[model samples]
Target: MSEGAKLTVQELDKRFGDGDDAVQALAGTDFSIAENEFVTLVGTSGCGKSTLLSIVAGLEEPTDGSVLVEGHEVEGPGRDRGVVFQAYTLFPWLTARQNVEFALRDEGLTKSDVRQRADQHLRMVGLERFASARPNELSGGMRQRVAIARALSYRPLILLMDEPFGALDALTRQLMQELLTGIWEQHRLTVLFVTHDVEEAIYISDRVLVMTNRPGRIKAEVPVDLSRPRSPEMLSDATFLEPKAQVLEAIREESLEALE
Candidate 1:
C-alpha cells in the first residue's frame, strides 16, 4: 500500500447480462485522482456510481478498461484500499472498541497492539469515550463513525466511500461532513467519495465529477475553487454556490437526457 495513493481509470466500461438483456452500466469512463486528493462522484441514481466505486475497490471487475493505483494495475481486493458504505455494518454484539479491533486483529497485530490501534482510531473519530457501547446503543451518526474507524484501522492507502453520509438526517449529515473532512486531512488519505447531493459534493470535494445517467461517463469536472479549511459559511458564499450550480446543471442535463 502506497501512502497517499494516486488512482488512474482509463476508458472504463462495465456490462451486465447478455444479448438483448445486456445492460451497460458504465461506458468509457476516465479520471485520475491525485494522492491525498478528495474527489467526489455524483450522478442520478443508478448511474453506475456505486458500480464504478466497487470496481475501484476491486470488488468487481470492469468489463473494459483498467484501474491503476499508484501506477500499478489493480488485480483484486488488496489491503491498500478501505471501503465504507452508507449502511453502518458494525457488529451489534461488539462494543465500539471491539468493532474497530475486529478489523485490526486479522492484520497480524498482537492483541494489545490491536487494542491500542482501536483506541487510536476511535479517538480519531471522537468516539473513544463510547468504546464500550455497542452499535445498537450508538446514534446513526456514531455508528457511521464506528464504521469509518474500523475501515481506517488497517491504515489503507485510500478510502472509498459510497454515500457514507446518505443515511443521516440533514443536520447529522452536515456534522459528519465536517468530521470526515477533518479525518481525511489529518490522515492525509486519498479519498474517493460518492454522493447525490450537489451542494454536499461541492462543499466537501477538491473537485467534483458529474456523471451522465446510466452507462455513465464523466460529464463535467468542476474544480471547487474554494479555499481549504472549509466551513458551512462557504455554502452561502459564491465560492461554493458557483461550482455547486455547475455540477448541478451538469447532472440535471444528463438526468433529463436519461428520461427522454
Candidate 2:
C-alpha cells in the first residue's frame, strides 16, 4: 500500500459458501487512494467491484487480507466513511431533511443542531426547498440528491459510492454526475466510486482501476489527465478519449476472459 494513503486495500480476498459450493469473489486485490483523490473501479459483470466497495465500506468482511483507512484496519462501518448506492436507500415515510438528520442522530448533537446541519447539506445539493418532500413524492434524481446529501451531512472522511446514478435516466445521470463532481471539487473529499459505465468513470475520476474476471483483482490503472473542473464538452475531447480507451480495453479483456 502507498504510504499515507487515505484508503488502502491489501491482498484482499473474499469467498462465499464452502468446498465445491464456494464462490470466490476477490483475490489479492490491492490498491490505494490518496487524500482528496477521486478513484473509480470498473470491471466486467461478476468481477466483484461492488463486493470490494462493500468491504471498504465495512458492510462486508473479506475472507483474508484487510481494508485500511487512515492506516487503521476497517473493522466495521463507521461515520468516518459515508456510503451511497444506486437504489436511493431512502425511507419513504420521512421527509428529505429527516432522512439526512437520521444519519447524524448518533453524533450526539442536539436536535436543533442536527436540523441545521441537515438543511445546510440539503442546500448544498440544491434540495433545501424540497426538504419536506418524502422519497415517494420525489423523482428518482431528486431522491438520489437526498441520498448524497444525507451521506455527506456528517462530513465523512471518504465517500464510497456504488453506481449511485446507475438507476437514473441518461439526462439525469449526466446532471447528477455534474452535481457530484461539483460537490467533490468544493469539498475535496476522498471518494471511492464503483461503476460499469466507462465514460462515467473517466469523466469523474482522477484514476480508474479495472478489475479482472473473478476472483477479481486489479488488472490495470488508467490515470485521467484531464484538467478539472471537468465539463460536458470534455467528453468529446481527445484527453478524455485517451483514458476512456485505456479503461475500456482493460475491461474488454476481462470481459472476454469471463465469456471463455
Candidate 3:
C-alpha cells in the first residue's frame, strides 16, 4: 500500500454457486483509495462495481484476498465506512431527520446528541427545511439527499456510494452531482463512488478507475487534470472534453469487443 492510501484491496476475487452454475464477479481485482480523495469507478453493468463495494463495506466476504481500511483489515461492517445506495434506503415511515438520527443510534450517543448531530448533517445536505418530511413526500433528489445525510451523520472515515444519483432524471442528476462535489469539498470525506455514467465520472472525480466487462478488474486509471470546483460549463471546455473523449473511446472499444 502507498503511504497515504486510506483503503486497499489486494487479489480480491468473488464467485457464486458451483461448477457449471458458477459465476465469477471479480477476478483478482486490486485498487487503493487515498485519504480525502474522491475516486469514481466506471464500467458497464455487472462489472463487479457494487460487489467490490460490498466487500469493502464488509457487507459480504471475498472468496479470496483482503480489503483494508486505514491499513487495517475490514473484518465486518463498521462505522468507519458509510454507504449510500441507488435506492434511497431511507425508512419510509421515518422523517428525513429521523432517518439520519437512526444511523447514529448505535453510536451510544444521547438522544439530545443524536438530534444535534442529525440536524447538522441534514443542514449540510440542504435538507434541513425538509427535516420533518417523510421519504414518500420528498422528491427523488430530496430523498437521495436524506440518504446522504444519513450516511454523513455517522461521521465515517470513508463514504462508499453506489450510483446514488442513478435513479434521478437528467436535470436532477446534474444538480445532485454539483451538490455532492460541493459537500465533498466542504467535508473532505474520502469517497469511492461507483457509476456507469462516464460523464458523471469525469465531472466529479479526482481520478476515474475504468474496469473490464465481466469478472472485472481495473483496466486503467485516468486522472482528471481540469481545475477544481468544476462547473457544468467546464463540460464544454476543450480541456475537459479531451479527457472525456478518451474515456468514452475506451468504454466504446471495450463495449464493442464485448459484443464480438
Candidate 4:
C-alpha cells in the first residue's frame, strides 16, 4: 500500500456454495484506491463488480485475501466506509431529513447535531428544500440524492457506490452524474463507484477498472487522462473517446468469447 492510499484490496477472492455447485465470483483481484480519488469498476453483468464492492464495503467477507482501509483491515461495516446502493434504501416512513439523521444516531451525536449535519449533506446534494419529503413523494433521482446525502452525512473515509445512478432515465442519469461529480470534487472523497456504463465510468473516474468475466479479475486499468471538471462536451474529445473505444473493444471481445 502506498502512503495516502485510502483503500487496498489484495488477491481478493469470493466464492459461493461448495463442490459441484461452487461459484467463483471473484478470483485473484487486486487494486488500490488513493485517498480522495474517484475510481470506477466497469464490466458486463455477473462480472463481480458488485461483489467486489461488497467486499470492500465489508458487507461480505472475501473467501481469500484482504481489504484494508486507511491501513487497517476491513473486518465488517464501519463508519469508515459508507455505501449507496442503486435502490433508495431510505425508510419510506421517514422524511428525507429524518432518514439521513437515522444514520447518525449510532455515532453518539446529539439530535441537534444530527439535524444540523444532515441538513448540510442534504444541501450538498441539492435536496435541502426537499428535506421534509418522504421517499414515496420524490422522484427516482431525488431519492437517489437522498441516499447519497445519507451516506455523505456519515463522513466516511471512502464512499462505496453500487450503480447509484443505474435506475434513472438517461437524462436523470446524466444530471445525477454531474451532481455527483460536483459533490466528489467539492469533498475530495475517495469514491469506489461500480457501474456497467462505460461512458459514465469514463466521465466520473480518475481510473476505470475493467473486469474479466466471472471468476472476475481485473483485465485492465484504463486511466482517464482527460483533464477534469469534465463536462458532457468532453465525451466527444479525442482524449475521452480513445479510452472509451478501448474499453468498448475490451467488452466486445469478452462478449464474443462468452458466446463461444
lDDT winner among the candidates? 2
TM-score of 4: 0.98
Candidate 3 achieves a global lDDT of 0.91
Error of 4 at 20 (Å): 1.1
Quick one: best TM-score, which candidate? 2
Using TM-score as the yardstick, the better of models 1 and 3 is 3
Runs off by more than 4 Å, candidate 4: none
What would the per-residue lDDT of candidate 3 be over residues 78-183, giving only the tens digit for each residue? Answer: 9999999999888899999999999998999999999999999999989889999999899999999998988989889999999999999999999999999999
Q: Comparing candidate 2 with candidate 4, which one achieves the higher lDDT?
A: 2
Q: Encode model 1's per-residue lDDT on 22-126: one tens digit a residue.
A: 999999999999988999999999999999999999999999999989988988998789999999988889999998988886699888899999999999999
User: What RMSD, rounded to one decimal, does every model reach?
Assistant: 2.1, 0.8, 1.0, 0.9
How does candidate 2 fare on TM-score? 0.98
Candidates by TM-score, descending order: 2, 4, 3, 1
Stretches of candidate 3 off by over 4 Å are none
Worst 10 residues of 3 by lDDT: 245-254
lDDT of all predictions:
0.91, 0.95, 0.91, 0.92
> What local lDDT does model 1 show for residue 229?
81
Each prediction's TM-score versus the true structure: 0.96, 0.98, 0.97, 0.98
Off by over 4 Å in 1: 1-5
- lDDT by residue (1-260, candidate 2, tens digit) is 69889999999999999999999999999999999999999999889999999999999999999998999999999988999999999989899999999999998999999999999999999999999999999999999999999999998999999999999999999999999999999989999999999999999999999999999999999999999898999999999999998888888887777778
